[model samples]
Target chain A: MPQIGGAPSGDGLQAVAMAIRILEYLAEQRGGIGVTALARALGTTKSRVHRHLRTLVETGYIVQSPESEKYRVGSRLVTLGRTVAENFDLSALAREEMRALRDTLGQSVVISRVEVTGAVVLATLPGREAIEIAVKPGSILPPHCTAQGKLGLAHAEPAVRERVLLSRLDMRTPHTITSPTVLREELARILERGWAVAPSESLLGVNALAAPIFEGGGGMVGAIAILGSIQFIEAEPSALQIRHLRQAAARISAQLGDVGRDGVDSLPR
Target chain B: MPQIGGAPSGDGLQAVAMAIRILEYLAEQRGGIGVTALARALGTTKSRVHRHLRTLVETGYIVQSPESEKYRVGSRLVTLGRTVAENFDLSALAREEMRALRDTLGQSVVISRVEVTGAVVLATLPGREAIEIAVKPGSILPPHCTAQGKLGLAHAEPAVRERVLLSRLDMRTPHTITSPTVLREELARILERGWAVAPSESLLGVNALAAPIFEGGGGMVGAIAILGSIQFIEAEPSALQIRHLRQAAARISAQLGDVGRDGVDSLPR
Candidate 1:
């Protein structure tokens, strides 16, 4: 049987666990969600979730969206985020790995953070002959198209994954995943295979491969993507290329204190 | 009567409220704290605080330092922080205000975020002939010295304020606040005045004035600083300079949804 409360079944206080999960769910929604949808996703009753939401919102861990009439992650979390990122140097931790992937794979390597709104590039290292050398640090990518975006979606919590599937899969290119059925299938493939690749999905003639970076506790902190020409990166990367990319991703994740494992089965997924 | 459980006296769940306050206290520490210190700061029993800390640590909201055995803000907060920041664009929101302040004052303007460690430049805009245009965005300033740093400290929680004063005030320059007693006195004055000034505390002949930026909820999101030579910004800003600086700060705080009031009586102090 599932645990009584919504949080993971453990020795910890159920109320606290539920509160954190509520914050996590709000974050995944990016846009926010009403209490009904939130409770349904969390596998708890509406009243229980409402109690937790009240506490979360009161502490500024979550905010009620005026337009959507749903709870979204709030600015207090943003304040804590800056404190933790600067304290731990999560972006700086990803730097050496990005440079290595760029040099070894001969493709531009980018570290993009997975946020509530979308996958935004945190930093990028250009490779030899890389076209998109100037990828701005904060550019957002469509989840249905880019390798980094897919990597994030594939590892998202079930509620979030379902919601994203139920939402619009914007067609960035002909190859982008536009159907829920197709996208679900691709996400399962990403979980099983440990990497995602896109050939002209985000843009024509551009190809990329990405692997997830996990925090020590299991959540996917971000993803490292290797970008290059369609001819170079190809429809599916070579075995050697995949091996190098995975190594670079694992190294960066290690710096961030991830469990040193990239497989979804071993992570928060 | 005080709330039986933990947390501020309110109509909400005491456990949840206490848990959130514990995280806030950790953030103010900008590092970690032992259970006793945390309990003492929150005015809760050690056992009660420990129970909450266990829940927080288990959820990755807080982590224990292996060496000091103190509980500190964890990576999960970093995760939530990222979700809040990019989702809300607190830094981006401050960027627009920086330009206006610079344009109006004819002095270089800067937006600096206050974190556990110190005050950091979040964004900057140049004046008509500002030579310090290259003030790196992430530069950290001595907390006991800069106008931005004092603005942050003046509004920090009592526990955090005491801790910062307890530490050695590094001598960045002869005029730096090197004495705990004097710095404490200055912080009280800053809280009363709603601003701070540093004449060569960071570098010789460089003068600056700063005001705190607040969110709608009365939290200090960041601070705005106007920098120039002794002739331009002045050791003590003229009534006109103070007026423009305060207006620019209030406008940015409004953008961030601060309550539009900055008296210490209304803020954390």
Candidate 2:
């Protein structure tokens, strides 16, 4: 085992990065992906990607389909991901709250960690309906587009907010707020109201309402949101939806040892 | 991106392997691990492991505790693992079957992918009882010492069986069959009876009975098992338990296009 010194030959680190990227891309794809397509997506050559894929296949991180000769994520890797999520205190604690929210609202509930880039979904419970809005856990919701994302951005640190403002905000839908000034103003409104809503922004007909979850030190660590079709989770959310969403967020934050009041105490009983 | 030629410098591949191993190890540990402990576990120096840990932490694959300086799996990696598992058809398809088995037997039901080494759990459903036998998905069962593992071995290819026979069988408990000759006889019996049980073998007070699941072309792809306390899932299982387990396995196999019968067709109602 030679030392991986900080030299160009230290491409060992690069290989590790490339392997993870490949697994991420495969995880996102519902269908199997070929070496060529993966190489293109990764901005690397076919052979390089091929070698990495081969190693991943051999290690049981990704499995190559016998019929299609394409690769997909393997069960071993899935187990690894699940184990990580299961071990996290945030996800474990939030799930019971999320289930309760789902039961009361009959709509899908999501809990997301507020990251610099956006809100990363940690857990989700599906709505109790024939037609439900379901977001995959581990998917990122962009800062400019989603209710969770917007609430996360509004509560995020100044530097994090500046980063999102400086970066290009790709329009997910026609309703997505791309202007930094407008988003800044929207963030102010969310702060004042103690909740956030993104109607037909991230997707054409989907809408969500979010409230912030704080940790012990009064830091907004995450958000709890309810999502559905615009028809259900309207542009102006129903009184019951807002009430339960705020209560759920507050409950989770309290369990995490946060004593901060996000105006939940002021809400009409 | 330099082409990693097959020299010792190709430790790029080694780095990738090391990163994955670290993740797998972290996923297993409930508490955060220190750099020294991880290095010791990997049989490497602290510095080498530290560098890998830094890369992982930077990439959100692992996180280091600011208070304790110990490391644990991060949410991003959990999401990746879950995404991979959700993308797999086997886990999705078998979940419904596992739920049904749990309903019928009131014992925890597990579905595992049969590998040369053992059975790797893909999905599991908790039993209806207050004291349930719950096995985590993604954990591996040893071929010589568990019900699912034995059923997998009984139906595996000859080369695979030989490989297991040649490997050292560690004694998990007093009842675990460490002798290859004894295990060989047990495998033959499982083949004849079309089911397998490991009572007080893997764990002292637990037992499991398993039947094989097959994919197209009559190949054994996995197994479905009902596990509980030894009091419930006895060494000599009830006829109802055997019947339901076999039926569930057959139903899943049929869905996968496997038409072969392991005496399932001849079982009395």
Across residues A1-269, which tens digit of lDDT does each residue of candidate 1 receive?
Answer: 22112334574777877887887767755455788998999899999987787676566665553334566665677766665555554467677767766777778888888865568888888788825543677799777788888888998878778888889778877877799998889989998889999889888888888888775467787888888788889987898788877877776665444545434332221
First chain TM-score for all predictions: 0.69, 0.66
**Residue-level lDDT tens digits of model 1 in B1-269:** 32113535683667778887887777756445788888898998999988887777667776554334666665678766665554554467677767877777788888888876678887788788736533678898667888988888888888788898898777877877788899899989988888899888887788889988876457786888888887877777898788778877877665543445443222221
lDDT top scorer: 2
Candidates' DockQ values? 0.20, 0.17
Range of the 10 consecutive residues with the lowest summed lDDT in candidate 2 chain B: B1-10
Candidate 1 reference-contact recovery: 0.42
lDDT of 2 by residue, A150-171 (tens): 8888877687698888799988
